[model samples]
Structure formats: structure tokens, C-alpha cells
Target: MGIKIGIIGAGGMAAYHIAGFRQAGAEVVALCDPNEAVARSAAAAHGVSRVFGDAESMFAALPELNAVSVIVPNKYHAPLTLQALAAGKHVFCEKPPALNALEMAEMKGLAERNKRTLMFNFNNRARPESVAMMDYVKNGEAGRINSAQAKWVRRTGIPGFGGWFTNKVLSGGGALVDLLHMIDLSMYLMGYPEPAWVLARTFDDFITDRTFKGPWGIPDAVNGVNDVETAAHGFVSFKTGQALSFQISWAEMVQREEVSAAFQGTKAGGMLRRLYGADGVDATATDLCEFYTQDHGRSSNRVVTVESDPDMGRVRSARNFVRSIEGTESPLNTPDQALILMKIIDGAYASARSGEPVKL
Candidate 1:
């Protein structure tokens, strides 16, 4: 039989997870959500036969499940993932693996001790352009990437304003947590350096500005509890003597959104963009990977054109995780890498609050 999978959330991401898993040849047998209506609806839509009001009930109901996709909010990642690991199920967790390094480390330990596969949904890493760029770095073509800059800025895209996303206690932080794809991919392309320090800043200027609320915005009390920053910027120095600068914003006064990662190396500089879909669903345009360097004492620019997966690599991520559980392949993004990311995020937030560089 194929992998028996369960989905632990009924949100937008959960829908995508279910479809991706099915496409990867997994049987999505069960789904769980605190909201009964939501869970039922998702189950019906996905042709899943089992639905539960909570993860505990689902866990008890489906003892034979081989794997689970934890697609809930940031606050519940640790608990849900821990529960899944305890149940001897391979876990596929959403990004920012957990709220902090400590929580992520605990989950990692549990997965390791249980001898189960644990993977992060850093699906963007599977993007053909990302794969190509990473190959360049790994093959010594991009030769010792020493400096990098990544940014994901939106003109007005506050996701679910006045909701858990804006609550620091629930979501950790806005923009930074939601837009971490850029930072994660940047670090991966830079060879996963060991961060030494972080200096950062954040702002909340557009939370109350209703004019800037876009498609993903929601209405709530004007003075709702929005304790997180709408935008953030950080500079990280790695022990390898390399450095990275990153910035992200959910709402900002800008002409258009910017999503790109540029790396400077001793041999050649490379830039990659469109790592994800335009609307984060499907790729509208092909990925762009460009290289710049001096050839024969003359500046030259090369655009490497390669075939890219039309699915934006989402399918690959889901399939690879399942295959890893089947012992067919190894995971590309593991909890240990996510732990490194968490440390950078924690340090960035700490530095933002203390106005001093935080040592990792």
C-alpha cells in the first residue's frame, strides 16, 4: 500500500498540502481541525473519508497512518509535530519549523529518538532555478559566496490582518515569519553558514492604515492586538566570514513587490528570482538565474536558461518527503537546518527589541 497520510489543519495551506500529497501518490485518509465545519468541508472536497475535530481524536482514529502534514499556524507547530512524532508517524512541518530554536530542537530530538523522518516544507528549495543556483554554489562555479542580500517586500499584502498573523504570541512576528522563504533560500544557496551575530530593525507603520490593506487583508477592531512588526530588516554575519542582509514586509509604501536573492562570490556573482509562484500558487513565468563576472578582463553577463517544473517545485517537496520515509531518498530540508533558521529569527527579533546586535 502507498503512504497513509493525515492532514492536521484545515486552513488554506492544508488544502494545498492535501492536494500535493495526493499528487505524490499518498492516500490522504484523515483530516483534523478544531472547526468541525472547516474540517468536514476540507475532507469532502479532498475525498478524504475520515474527519476529526482535533488532532488527538484523529490520531486515535487513524492508528495506521504512516505520515502527517502539520499545516497549522505557527503557534501549534511544535505541539502538533511532537504529537505526530510520538505516534511514530513521519512528519512534514510548515516553515519556520517552530516558534523558537528551543521548541524546534525538542521536536528534532523527538523525531531523532523515534527514528522517524522529519522534514520542513521549504518547498521553494525544489524550484528548478533554486536547484540550479544551488548547483552553481555547490560546484564551485559561484565560488565561495561571501556576501548575499535577499528581500521580499510587498506594496500592500498583510495576510489576515487583526488575526493570529498580527499577534506576536500566536505567529511569532509578521512579515519576517511569513516572508522567511527568501531568507531560508538565501542561506541555503549560500551553503547554510553558521550565523555568528544578527543586527536588525522592525516597524509597524501600516497596521492601522486601512488604505493599504490588500486582497489577503481582513477586517477587525481597528485597535486589535497587533503586537508584531509589519516589516523587518536584518544583517547576519556567519562564522565562515560570510554575511547576508535580508528584509521583508507585509505592508509598505512601495510601487511594487520585490522578490530576489543576489549573491557575490570570489569567482562569479549570481542572482535568482521567482523562486515561487507569482501568487504563491503556480508559476506564471519561468525562473531567472543570471551570472555576472569578468571574462578575459572584460565584464560579461550570462543568463542560464534551463527547464523548470511548472508546479513551482511544490510537488517535488511533498513527493520527496514521502519517498524519504520509504527509504527511497534523503531529505533536503531537515529540522537541523530549520533550527539554524530559528536561531537567526530569534536573534533578529531580540536585536530588534534591544537595539543591539545579538550574538548567536
Candidate 2:
């Protein structure tokens, strides 16, 4: 029995959703995008038999669709998801579930009322490296995690000039939104610790003003009103006294692009990233048992070489979500977990707003 799936939003990410759904063995029945060309192109690409310019039209025309993968802008997530749930479709929405906590709660309530499964495309959690690390920590391979850090730092990069990403209303926040998975991965390795508070600061350089005087490629000085930050710093605390910090920049005065996460515990420590590695306190990999030893009245450091396979890390989350739909398992990226993340992010912004620490 093949599950019928419809896709909303025909953006760059819509393609990924189509691919993941196909990989999960769902039948691509319908496609919806505001742009007709985009919808047609996406339908052709995914072998979806139908296409529409709006989700309401798609839903009304294809009421038999069993599931929907929503990959729309942040502002429309709540209502779109609510309608899908009301129409009796299991929903897999893109991350940052809604614009805020209240919106999240509304959708959550709808899912409960409609008895639908609501999950996020938190592909970060589905990665094999992340799974391998979770197994290691839970098996006492990394000891008790006391501190962790995650970074999806990129050199100078920002999407869309005069676009939604740079506008707070459309994309929520800047680097935090982009680095959400970075933050998610850290807590995931620590067994999904309960976040207690967020202390954060956001920074926005006039990258757009200096580079593209107008909208990206639009070339109009009057259109330079994207007020979102280009970089951010966040310090978070968990219920177990575990601490997490992150540094991420989408566009800034920087030199390179690198992504990684670090876990520190009592016995062993581990780190993951693309470039530029920094070992943490009491953290040691299998081979780096001596890089940071107890040196009385002395200090030293050594480059640690850890082995990892990044490619194989992307299929687990898909399997988890698919199996849950197949009624053989439960969802890993549940609606509740997505709400937890949104709360943390909301707290981060609140902290930045009032220049004070926010208790979770």
C-alpha cells in the first residue's frame, strides 16, 4: 500500500522534500507552488501527476492525499499546516514550526484535535554521524555530558537581497534560523536535555548596504530595508546543568565556512565539524587520550585527528519518519520537540530584545 503525498511550496527546499518523500516510499500525488512554472517543473522532476498554484486548490482537487510536506515561508506555516491537518493529512513541516510560540501552540492543538502526525524536517537529527554519536553517549562512551557546543559557521553568505530571510517577519531571525540544526544537534547528543534559558545577541552588518545597494540583483537603493541580523551568539542552559553555546554568521566580515559540534563530559569528549576544530574541557576522542593532559603548572595542546563519515549521516531521520508513518515506530522529530526548539529560539530573541536573561 503506497501512501499518497502532496507537496506545498515550490522553492529550493521543496525539491529536497520531494526527494526525501520519494526515498521514504511515498507516492508523489500532487504538487503546489505559487509559481506555475515552478510547480510544473517540480512535478516533472518528481514524477508527481498533478500540480497547483495554491495548497487550498490542491487540497480541494486532491482530497485523497494522505500526507503533505510543507516547505513554505515561515509566515504561512501555521495556517497552511492547520488546514492540512483539518483536511486529514499527516504533516511534515519544515523546521521552525511556526512564526512563534503562540502559532506553534495553535498548530499543535489542531494536530491533537485532528489526530494527525506533525513532524519537522529536522534532517540534522537523521544524520548517521549524529545517530552514531547519540549511541556513543547513551552507551557511556562519552561519559556524562557537562558542556556542549555547536557551530554551523559559514563565511560571508546571505540568501536573497530585500528578501524574506533578512526580514524578521518572514524568516523569524537570521543566523539562528540557519544554525538551528547546529543547536539541535548538540542537545540531541546529550539526550535531548531540557533547555532552561537563552542568553543571546544578534548582530547585523550593512552587508547589503555595502554590497548590493538594492534587492539582491535588483539594483535599487530604495529597496535596502532587510533589517534582520547577519550573525548571532547564543548561550543556553539545560535542566541538567548542561551548558551550550553557539556562534554562527550568514554574512559578515569573515574568512571561511565551517560546521561542527563539540561534546564534553567527565571521561571522554568528541567534536564534529567541517573545518577549524577546537577541543573542549575533559573531552577526548578515542585517539586523543593525551592531547590535553593534567599538567601541573603547565599547559599544552595538540591537533586531534578524529575519523567520521559525513555522507552516510542523512538517511536515518528519513527512515525514522517513514517507519513512524508505516505504523512500525514513533516519530523522532515530534511536534513537542519542535516546540521545545521554537521556545529556545524565542527566548534567544527575547534575551536580545530586553538585554536580559530569559528563564525557560
Clashes of 2: 9
Alpha-carbon RMSD, each predicted model:
2.6, 5.9
Per-model TM-score, in order, reads 0.93, 0.84
lDDT of 1 by residue, 7-30 (tens): 888876776677677766889999
Tens digits of lDDT, candidate 2, 1-360? 878888898776666666666777877789898888988998887688898999889889987888898888788888899999999998988777888878898888889988888888777666555565666677885678889887765554565566666677877877787567878778777777789888999888754754522222223334645787777888999988999998877765554456677878775677665543223111331222122223364644334543443332334454455567888776767777777788888998899888998998
Model 2 residue pairs with clashes: 126-317, 127-313, 128-313, 161-216, 259-273, 260-272, 260-273, 269-283, 269-284
Q: For residue 237, give model 2's deviation from the true position in Å.
A: 1.4
Listed per model in order, the count of residue pairs whose N, CA or C atoms clash below 3 Å is 0, 9
